[model samples]
Target: MRVLLCTFIQIVMWCGYSIVLFLSHHDHNFYETILMLMFGYFNFLVAQRLNINKSVALNMTISLTLIYVTGKMIIG
Candidate 1:
């Protein structure tokens, strides 16, 4: 149940991040990158608390970020 919840939270955060990127026209300044990294770190912490594997959590974070970025680019 916790794993499912964490997955859902990550997905929602990805979507929100994608929307922000799209709105900003993908300029992606340093601050935005920092913010994204912070978010990823938060996700990692959540996954740790939920007893998820570190590698799997990291993989999911990278994959979701890539997926959202690709989607934003393709849609724009």
Candidate 2:
């Protein structure tokens, strides 16, 4: 049951990320999108390796992304 719940949450996160990515497609270049995807995948792998909860890891990733975006906007 816990595994199923985690999987569901991860799926939701992925879907949300995909929609956001799609919406902002014009804002990012292909290389930037690829790099973001790579970073997300790497973050998931590290979280799994560390035995961290999927939801927590995904939340952290979202937080980090928001932080990055916020910083970029502020700096610009």
Candidate 3:
């Protein structure tokens, strides 16, 4: 049940990222870099606390992507 919840959250985050990425397709590396950093650090922190490597990695990836998309929008 916990795994299912985590998976569901990942799926939602993924869908959100896809939509943002698609809409901000023209954004360059600056946005991407910021996003990656944000995700890496955020995920690292969360994972460290929860002791869940996979979720941490997954969340960071999704978080970075969503952040990048959002950054692109702000700067677009």
Candidate 4:
């Protein structure tokens, strides 16, 4: 289904973002910010397409935080 596909894509994106964030050294750098923003924006689009936009911010934040912590631990 579309939802499943979207969710899978989001997870892949999150992992990719985390990997880049780990490699970037400066987590708060412009590149990382852009990556996060893009992920968030793309996530929002997916939610909007699914008519579930309201929870996008919360979901994105939670996922971002969790992935970030995981990435830190993984690549530390």
Candidate 5:
């Protein structure tokens, strides 16, 4: 459940950022590289805060990534 919530937050963080960037110039893929690192950092934070295993953190990050992708699709 905590993992799932982290995923949601991850998606929301990216989506909110993407939308704001999109408003300026529509460079959607521009944020991917940065988000990759961000996700890594976030996963570390998740592991620390949630005291979860690496696998759980990774899976949760993936779920969150999916949310970002789907959100952009739905919104755009």
Candidate 6:
């Protein structure tokens, strides 16, 4: 249950972050990178508390990277 909730929160947060960045015309500046990293850190905390496997963190990083890269490609 906790794992599911953590996954859901992570997905929602990523989507919200991406939407905000897209709408704001962000240029992937320092602040945007910091915000992204913060979200990753938050996910780490939640996953840790839920006693989830470490691979979840890797998966989150990979997933976010892919989404960000794909969005950049499509937007450009």
TM-score for each candidate, following the candidate numbering: 0.69, 0.55, 0.45, 0.51, 0.53, 0.61
Q: Using lDDT, rank the candidates from best to worst.
A: 1, 6, 4, 5, 2, 3
Best by lDDT: 1
Find the number of clashing residue pairs for candidate 5. Answer: 0
Candidate 2: C-alpha lDDT: 0.62
Question: What is the lDDT for 68 in model 4?
Answer: 60
What digit string (tens of lDDT, one per residue) describes model 5 on residues 1-76?
7666765666666666676565756445656556556755765576557766777777766766676667767987
Per-residue error at 68 for model 4, in Å? 7.1
Better of 1 and 6 by lDDT: 1
For model 5 the local lDDT of residue 24 reads 58
Misplaced by over 4 Å in model 6 are 19-28, 58-65, 68-76
Of the two candidates 4 and 6, the one with more favorable TM-score, higher being better, is 6
Residue 21 miss distance in model 6 (angstroms):
2.9
Q: How many Å off is the CA of 7 in candidate 4?
A: 0.4
The best candidate by TM-score is 1
Give candidate 4's TM-score. 0.51
User: What ranges in model 4 sit over 4 Å off?
Assistant: 27-34, 46-76
Flag the better candidate by lDDT, 4 or 6: 6
- Please write out the lDDT profile of model 1 over residues 1-76, one tens digit for every residue: 7667878888887777667766886575796788778777887777787888888777877777777667866987
Question: 13-48, model 3: which lDDT tens digit per residue?
Answer: 545655766788799979956764654555445444
Candidate 2: clashing pairs of residues:
none
Candidate 6 lDDT over residue span 23-66, tens digit each: 87746588787877887777677677777778876675557656
Alpha-carbon RMSD to native, per candidate: 2.8, 10.7, 7.8, 3.8, 3.5, 3.0
lDDT of 2 by residue, 1-76 (tens): 5444544555565556657766776774776667667766765665565666877767766665666557656965
Model 4: which ten-residue window has the lowest total lDDT?
52-61
Clashing pairs in 5: none
lDDT of 4 by residue, 9-65 (tens): 677777887677668875666767687787777766765667655675457546755
